[model samples]
Structures are given as C-alpha cells and as structure tokens.
Target: MLNSEFIATVEGDKVPRKYFDGRGMYIYVQPSGAKYWRLKYRYEGLEKTYAMGVYPRVSLEIAREKTEEAKQLLIQGIDPNEYKKNQGFEIVAREWFENKKDGWKSRHAQVVIDSLEKDVFPYLGARNLSAIRPPELLTIIRRIEKRGASRVAEKVLQRIRAIFRYGIQTGRAKNNPASELTGVIKTQKVQHRKALPIEELPAFIQDVKNYEGMTSTRNAILLMLLTFVRTDELRSATWDEINLEEKVWHIQGDRTKMERPHIVPLSHQAISLLKELPSYPSKGYLFEGRKAGHSISDKTMIHALYRMGYKNKATIHGFRGVASTVLNESRLYSVDVIERQLAHIDGNATRRAYNHAQYLPERETMMQWWADYLDEAQGINQVGIVGRLKGLFSR
Candidate 1:
C-alpha cells in the first residue's frame, strides 16, 4: 500500500522504477523525476498497459478507482482504452473546459459549465461527438428560447461551437454541427443598462446617502459611482491595489474586462470614501463577504439599489452610463480623456498601447471634477467645478 507521504518522498534514480499497488496498477518513476500512473492488464490472452494519468495530479485514490473501472470493463468483455477513444460528448466537453478554463475568470468558467450541464448535457451529452447533427442541437436551443431566455440560448450555442472546435482540434470530432446553426435562432434585441437621468441624479444621490443597509454595501455603491469602474473590479479590489498617497487604484490586467492593466485617478472624495470603508486598512479584499476570505456577492450592490426603491429605474452598472453622459454633456473634458478615465478600450490597437497613461494629468483633473459633481449633487455645496457644470445642464 502507498500513502501520500511515501509518494511525496519518492525520488528518481539513474534507472527507472515501478512501484506496484496490486490489481495491475502501479506508479512508474522515470530517471528524469517524472512520475506516471499505469495499469497493467491482459485482454484476450494479450498483455497490455494503459496510461491512467500523472501523479500528484492523478493521486493514488483516483488511480485505484481507475483500476476498478478497468476491471469492470474487462468483466463485461470491453476494452477500457477502446472506450476512452470513443468517449461521449459530455466527457470531451469536460476535458476541453479543464484545458481552457485557466485563461478565463472563475465566475465565467462556472457559468459556462453550469449552462452546459443544465441545458446541453441532458440531451446530447451521452451521444457520440460525430453522431450529433444540427437539427438535434437546435431542438435543445429552441427549448431554451421557448422559456424566454433568448440571450442564454445564444450564449449556449456559442459555447457548443467552441466545444466542437476543441473536439476537432483534439481529433475527437470530425464536423461541427453547432457552427451552421449560428443565425438560426431568435436573438433578443440589445438593451443598454438603465441609468438615472441627469435631472434625477440629485434624488438618487440623496437616497444612496440615506441608504439603510450594511455600511460596506453603501460604501461600495459610492465607490462605484465615483470610480465608475466595473462592478467586479471594484468589489474584488484588494487593499494593496490602492495607493492613497499616489491617489490611484492600480487595477491588474487579469481583473479588467479588457485584460490590460488600468490606472484609475482617485478623487479626493473617492479617497475619503475609501478611508471610511470597514476593510480600509485590512490586508485582504476591500469588501469581505459573509464567507471568510471571499469578496462580497455580486448581487450586494444591486440588491441594495432595489431596497432603496430603484428596482427597474437604475442598476449598479448604470452608474458608468450616468458618468459618461454627464461628462460628455458638460463639454469640459476631451473625449479621449473621458474614455481613458472610464477604461474604455480604444478601437485602434497601436493607439491603445500608448493611451493608458497618456492623459494622466487631464484625467486626474477630470476625476476630481466628476467626484465634486457628485458631492454637489449630494448637497455638499462645493462650488468650483460643480457649480459651473450645474449651470451648463438643467437640474
């Protein structure tokens, strides 16, 4: 019997070694310090070896389970290797997800797998990759559309296409049935997020100031309004990312929607709000959830808005739209500066490379002005930039 401690301590020698665990399963160690799990078996009077997987990745327990599964196949007069070669769609999709999930955010990866399990796998999962045709896949998509989830239906189709593409690259599939069905489904019209009109901004600000929820949740809404960064970027922010002396929030590339590093010029008001947060001086995430070591749930800010009576009238994301509208309407800042401050990606690749920090000074001024605008709306009565901007627009 092999224990994890013994396996962890095993070292390679000049010659390769095999440690058997009985029932034809063993760990093979190479001279190069590589360890692999293999199963030795006999089928039809011929000796064969199947490569289970590599260790620590494939632990001793999983290797034993594979051994039992192989024995069951042998009892039923089937070859485990043959079954693996002709694996069903579900198996291949899961393998593809594991291979590709490293590049995606955790939340997005979960959504992809959940969609496949809920709407895709029940019908087509057991079928062979090559056997599933366009019509059969369409039926499942139509079922989703019938339930008024046209957007989800479209996303499911896109995932199926990507899965089939992975299958072909891995030599597990010949043709992609989902490719031809792209435009066949009914897609819902694009609806922009609802933003409170500029006229209604003062009242919304008052409601948020008077919000009676968790103090952290209230601070989150205020931060989002001030920074206008993406919801995930703000909520998942760590204390180390903030440089109070530098007046900046350095968002790492992995956290941004554009997958590029972004610099936010924090306003005086934004800085004051940050100092008042419960986790301001903490070493971990800015907003700690009920679960230890995790950030607050994505629904926290939105649900806070609902409680404040802004159910369909506004959204957390809507704050970005409101800021853009107010800034563009104010005509006090350049388009490029406003866009860069908002972290909007530039369409031109060459220009985008150099534009992230191009307008730092102007952006600092604009961010401060925007923050002051919000403060004035909240009845703080700062009259420098906010007073001028207020005169430019009604209410």
Candidate 2:
C-alpha cells in the first residue's frame, strides 16, 4: 500500500486543494506545484490527521511509513495525533529543561544551554520522536568526548535522558534512546585536591597579590577564595545581595548549588575588599563582567594567578579547599558551624535543620586571619584602604 513513485510524482489533481488517495493518506498540491503528504485518521471517533512533512523532503515511501505508524498507534488505543506530537521529544525536552533551570546557578544554566545547542539540537533536533536511536545518543556523547570535554559529554547525556523520560510520560517519544546509553562512556572521576595548608598560606598570598589583572577581577577572585562559595554564586553576585552592616552576603537560591538561599557572614576582610572596588559605571552587580549584564569570566582569577607565577601550583577553587582544611583542622568552630559557614549541607537532621547562621565570632576572626595572611604574602603592611573600608562595616 505504501509505494514510492505514487507519492513521489505529483500528477492528476481533481481539485486545486488536495485529496486523500487511499489508506487515509492525502496528497496536497501547492500553488507552485510542490507536493506534500499528510495522513488522515481518526481515534476515539475523533477526526484527526498528521502532517507527514513536505514532499521530496519526506519522500513517498517515508510518508507511507509515517501513515502506517500513525495507524499502528491508533490501533494501540493511542491517539495518532498525540503520538505524533509526542514523537518530537526534543520540543518536550526543551520545555522541561527551561522549567528545571530556574534554580540552576547562572553559570550552570549557560553551560547547559551551550551544550544542548551544540550537541543534541544539531543531530536530533528536528528528528521525529520515533527516529532517535540509542546508538545515536552514544554517538552524540562520543562526539563531546572526542572534543576532550568528557565531563560535559556525560552531563549532556544525562540531560537528554531526562528529556526522553519526560517525552515518555507525555506520550511523545516511544522509547528513551538515552536510557540504553548507560555505562557506554567512561567519565573521569573529579576529586578535588585539598588546598595547600594555612601554614603555607602567607607564602601563597604574597605570590598572588603581585599578579596583575583588572582590579575588579583581582578583587573578585580574592573574594571567592576568601568566601569559598561556588564559582557562579560569586560571579553573578549583585550589590543588593550584600549587607556591609550585617557583614553578610545573602546569595539567592537560584544562584546557589543547593537550590536554597544561603547567608554568608562575610569577614571584615572580605567586606573591605568589596568596599574598595571602584564604583560600577552603572548600578547592579557587585562585580559586573565586561558584558553589561553577565558575570565576569571564571578564568579571570586563575589567569591572574598564572600571571603571578602560581600556574599549575594554585587554583581559585583551591581557596575553598584551603579554607575548609584550615578551619576544620583548627577546631576553632564546631563542624556544624564551619559547615554552615561554608554553605555546605550535611545529611544529618540537626545540620539540615540548622536554621540560624553560625560561626560569627570565629568566622570573623578567621576572615581577618586570611586577610592578614594575604597581606603578609603580598608583603604589604595594610590591606584595602583600612579606615575607608571598615567605615562601611556597620551598615
């Protein structure tokens, strides 16, 4: 019943419109003589038909296959139109992605968006629901892997699978091609190296302050190292998020890794750094990127360090590692207090239930100590326009 030539060559037309030849498949004639195939069908006694795509682009044989597939779904008690819509899993997946991304950190949102655009959308963006195969998913991930972004490759696969699962629930995709792709690719384990000890911290700080970059970037990097918040939370930080008086930075939930708001009681030292930053040409983010609205590049700080000769030896993230190491080893604050100050959540009930911020006294002291360390390393006796910075302290 599904023939190629019959659907391919457009000939006799009884009307200027279109006509269903047989088996409920219609041949549509255009003003310019282009032909298109559509399948006419009914489900639950409701009349419905599906666009089989344009002729030549969707050949006669392909149209027939699509028609038969629709009929099969109808026979299976699923509305063919519904199934056809569901078949375009990518559309459903994208909708799902947007909905879930509301709480993702800004940096994460950008990365995920870039990954989907470059990898998934190109190969399978327009493919019908029934078309994507597991082998195809493997190939897509392998392509990302070949580019040396193995972690990103695996993450893209996970997001794609989430979309397929959504498609299955909505009756768009038949089976998850991504579901069968488990264990197909090997991902390198990410083990964060502990930061070099506080004992060696002064030496490290002196090394860093000597490096050169835009003053704002240098300040932002030092702040991140001191605060130990996630990369994104720091970069997307807004002026409104700070309270120099309260000595805290309330990172909004959307920018936090935990998908919950965090209150960072900034040490006097950190606040000093913020206060010393030049007034923004425009008002908004604390550290606005070169772009009007976006945050500064994550690499800016690391590059600063590299220029200062800490290349391959120190990292911006290492600041957190160092902070966690020193504070925890010193036992200056309870594990809970340090964890909370660190904006880290532990699985224990009490820790999770810790509603009030802790470690105020000790954190203030540690922050000062960290600042002193950096000053010592940089061989500077004073830090961040002391009186001017401290004046903004109470508010």
Off by more than 4 A, model 1: 1-81, 84-86, 104-119, 139-155, 184-186, 192-194, 197-200, 230-264, 271-300, 311-313, 340-361, 379-390
Runs of candidate 2 exceeding 4 Å displacement = 1-65, 69-90, 97-112, 145-155, 182-185, 190-200, 203-207, 230-233, 236-246, 251-263, 278-292, 339-395
* Cα distance off (Å), candidate 1, residue 291: 6.3
Clashes of 1: 0
TM-score of each: 0.61, 0.63
What lDDT would candidate 2 get against the real structure? 0.71
Best by TM-score: 2
lDDT of 1 by residue, 1-395 (tens): 77878777899989999998899899999988899999999999999998887898788898898789789999999988887666678989999899989987565577689899999999988776865789988999999999988767887898899889988998778899999896978857877889986767777887888998887788888889999999989988888889999999998775676767899999999999889887879778888887887788889999999999999999999899999989888888899988987888889999877764658999899999999888777764334435555677754
lDDT string, candidate 2, 67-179, tens digits: 88878877789887665554565677678778878876555577677778888888888777666778888889988888777766877888898888887776666688888
lDDT of each: 0.85, 0.71
